[model samples]
Target: MGSPPWAADPAPASRLPATNLLTIEYPGYIRDTSDSLDRALVSLSPVAGPRVDAASSAYALAHLTSLLERGGRVVECRLPSGSGVPDAMDLYKHPILGDVTPSDHVVVRVHRQVWKRMVNGQEERRKHYRIEVLGASSTCIRFRRMADYAFRPEMPAHASEHPTMKLHKILEEMDVAAMHAHRFMPEQEDYYDGQGAQRRSNLAMIPPPFFNRQELPFYYGYRQNPTSSLQTVTFASTSKRSRRTARKGDADLLDAGNDHAEVTRYLNRARWRNMAPVAVKFTEDGPVPTEPDAMLAQMALSERQLAYLERLKKHLSERPVWSRLSLLNQFSVADARALVQTKELFALVAYTFADGPWRDALVRFGYDPRQDMASRFFQRIHLRGKAPRAPTTRGAFKAEYGQASASGKAAPAVGDAQARPATHLFDGQHSTFSTSTFQLCDITAPVLLPLIHAEGPSDLRSAPDITTGWYSMSAWEAIRSSVSKSFHALLSEAGPHKTSEEAIESSEGSGAGDSSEEDE
Candidate 1:
């Protein structure tokens, strides 16, 4: 049961191109390969967002981070090797961005002690290319979720405060409309403002989760990293505020009333004017936290949330409401029986006009086609593996009337048509791993109908098998007859002693010519 020593080779030497960065004479001390590599690497990322990917909390902690501008270069002020500034100028300008030669390194340092806690033992659920290095290659890079897609802000009333925060607020207020409106464009603003008619601006409306000062500097170097630098949905947002301030006066306006009043006072008053270093405390969470800080943390639930769930649970326990629901809500039914003290009141609904009135109502009322086509519908059928006690939606129909046979070790039941549809039933009663996966296979369905999706690997079943049995024998006879006729024709063309006859005729002609020559 233990892991073997052979399983733990921790070297990535195969991924690196060369072990060292040799300063060579190319492209005015060109990073031609590095530049090209970075662009190619970043194009594959899925990390674009306002600020960060929150759910990737586990992975982001394990690695170093940086940003990559379009042109291949790190723009951070200092690097991990502690390079103060990069050593090239022509590397700044790109053809698309009109030549921006890579010129800096972005450095972010976390104590190596805490590094293991973040990235260790995560189960990888996706596929990615593994970059192999050539020498003393200690570089371990992977595309954190890609983040560099262009997104125009829906300019909230307060967007000018700070771009990322504005986006954070927008996401917190996320609706289908806002997400649907999101567009990814490649071009940033032109380098010069209107061909010198106006002032030039280098600032880009970087999507939410901008990098820290040290991070931007190292952007170019990280861009070329094939393994991890691709922007992806996995690349989460940065945790802390960098040293850079978005605006001078805007901070005061944002911190108007609460706890940061003291910090704001220090910023505002004469003490700072004479001499005040203005102490600042940084937190992973923003300026204020929900807890009062007397206790380390609080488990206190929000009154609104607790009350809503409580009353809703209570109402469902009542007679008419309880009778309306199906067996799937039994855990609540059990709890509701305990809460209001009435099993008679919360008796599960036995049979109905429709298996699910509410879901049908949603369809009747008009659900969006995209929402109607969402995978959740498919999962409801494929996931149950056996059928539910109450059936609703297209997936239910697709599973029952459409599927051929339950072939998976874990697929839903492929019972005959006589079995009652059981969409109303609870999942646990039929959910044993022995009978757990419901797969369907080896049955023919209505011709031209799409087959039911397999729930797992064991569910792979072949299409209706059409045996080409007796027909193959008849085709063989036809082939035999054709071959016999061809053989006879070939024999006729070869006629007996054909080559000898031609030789005899040629010899006779030669003899006659000799006789004539002799007479002459």
Candidate 2:
């Protein structure tokens, strides 16, 4: 009934200032699915946003077909079973390639219907043709096709053509150009009362900021600061002119502007000022629930592995860290361990809003349901943090890690220690990467809803301090989808306070309810 808080104010008549563009590149691949004859080669690229990739692939195939037809070759086109778009592998087919010995030639099976002179002057006989389109580099496409009706063979001497060289070059260009035009969810904004004080706060949102590893020294703050971990990036979309220029098989016709839409950061923001408060499990005042065994089961860990994880749990549970900072609890332990085991990390995250017309918006944008676009925003979260700035010089590595040799005695610092993975695995004594891994969990709020992690069975033997946070299914229903009062009280208590030096000193000295002091 009303405008959502996240909606941006309409742009004025004047244009906004120019912003730098970010070119996000993704790898491409080819899949063969000739198992059912329904599909042969499916051109795939992980670059397009949501459904755009599939559509672009189909258009590319159509263009390839047109280029072949223009060469004055006998070409028979086969439509897919339904209203589905053209497939890359099914563009053309023939019957003769089945008999031809595999050789170094661009073999094509095409069809032509010719009128018969002996049988009947008006009757037409379909003939199968095999043409090998050769390229300058000896590369060839074994093109094949079947005629509408079986009749006789035409151009039986394995005809050869050379247009494939141009086709190959054209296809390469299309793949490269594919990177230039793409789309993604735009940034979102919302208003919030600053920590229970009766005023709104400004916040920006991005989904799935990390796809490989987390970068340490990166800050997770409301505004970009020296400590902020997330950086700004741009997602370019096809310009209106480019859309008009998109013609089948012609890469050069694509619009050059690649219209710049909204700019977004690499992370989502929680607007409440009191977000850092450490929560208790199953308590009315905290985020977790009363029963959490089911949640823990999802991690699928053995007792021994769970026991090892306890060290991390204990470290995170310490006073100031729990209250003032965010860390991975139980729900994320299995995922965390997996990251370490694989030496790679990726967590898929989706953008969520308190309440909005998200489904309708996704539909309007032509996103497929499976694209997870209806989730509003989708991102692959990478958890590994970049190694801290390489210690400035060679000695710095020794200074950072302390121990230089395997023997009991000290060894001379020679090469760069930072280059070693072992250097990043631990702190002076403890596992700093493990600790930082927990920190990453907090930064990326996996649970988008309001509910927090609840308590679990006492028999469980993993981390004593590490408890996972999840949405309280029962509590959520009991409240009739309303937020718990304890949350509101938290905001009231955590509201922004006086920032004058005198007030700040007094608050710091008191240390009664100050979560920030936990860091110190």
Write down the lDDT of every candidate, Cα atoms only. 0.27, 0.29
| Model 2 root-mean-square deviation | 32.7
| TM-score for each predicted model, relative to the true structure | 0.12, 0.17
Model 2 misplaced stretches (Cα beyond 4 Å): 1-144, 147-304, 312-520
List model 2 lDDT by residue over 1-520, tens digit each.
9887767776445333333221111122223454322232222211222233363445544644563456422221222324345423222221221111123332233555555554554665666564433222222233232223221111112224222222333454676664344332243242433365543322112213222332234345665544434433223333344344344444433434533433323332432111111122222222222222232324455665565455444543341122111222222334333434521111101111111211111011122222232121211111222223334435433333333455544755433232223312211122222122222123222222222232333211232111211212343232211111211222333332232233334434554232221110
* Residue-pair clashes per candidate: 88, 30
**Candidate 1 lDDT over residue span 341-447, tens digit each:** 32222111111111221111111111121223121121111121222332333553343233434476676534322332332331211211111111111111221
Name the best candidate (by lDDT): 2
